[model samples]
Target: MKTFLFRSIIGIFFGAFLAVLFTNAIVIFEGRETLDGALFIKNSIGSILCGWFSAVSPLYFEIPSLKLSQQTALHFVTLFILYFLLAFGIGWIPFTWNSFFITVLIFIVFYLIIWTCFYLYFRQQAKKLNAELTNLQR
Candidate 1:
């Protein structure tokens, strides 16, 4: 729990940085500007909280007795729900059907990228371990 809290706090800073960077980029490219410093501060705080929750929520998943595929699907479903609720709740995006679809799609892509990286890393580790075991047996 302590480590999780620390991770969440770190995620807050990361999320805030990404939020500011993207906001500035949008303003530059899209001509859509924030009205004031206060709005920007509010957005920063909202994004920070959203990041904190997103980073920490996965710790609570406890589905057992399922195959890895089933567990992974459930894990993604949980993430989609968490991202959707938190994003909509924070006013980070609008509440239209189009907005919902776009947000969900983005969330799914984010998770897929993360999972793929982890999968590749672990697969490499497993291959190394198997080769080591083969050498040991020989």
Candidate 2:
């Protein structure tokens, strides 16, 4: 558990650095004229990557489980909650949509995309790790 936690922390740190670097690059290349475009893209990507890391960390680095599916489900749930909270927090954009419905729709779509990617990636990793463990046991 300790080792997994350590490695997961390292992964999150690395992921965060990558997010910042990518966001900076976008701002430099895309010019400051389009604040909304740049900020939207940067925020979406950063949040997705953050969600992915948070979701996968438990499965890849932290917990050992008797059933791989169980672990994956737990991780997925955690990621979903984290992403929802993030999306909700940012849902009320300072000056965008006039109606709350449109705002929520946008937020939900963004959250779905990020969550889907996180789920797929976590599933792949869990499968690979479980296979490796099986081989080791054999």
Assess every candidate by TM-score.
0.67, 0.45
Tens digits of per-residue lDDT for model 1, 6-35: 878888988898788878887999898554
Assess candidate 2 and give its lDDT: 0.63
Error of 2 at 47 (Å): 5.1
With candidate 1 superimposed using the best TM-score fit, by how many Å does residue 35's alpha carbon deviate from the native? Answer: 5.3
Q: lDDT tens digits, residues 48-79, model 2? A: 55645663556533456436667656665666
The number of clashing residue pairs in each candidate reads: 0, 0
Which runs in model 1 stand beyond 4 Å of their true positions? Answer: 23-35, 58-67, 136-138
C-alpha local distance difference test of each model: 0.76, 0.63
Q: Which number leads on lDDT? A: 1
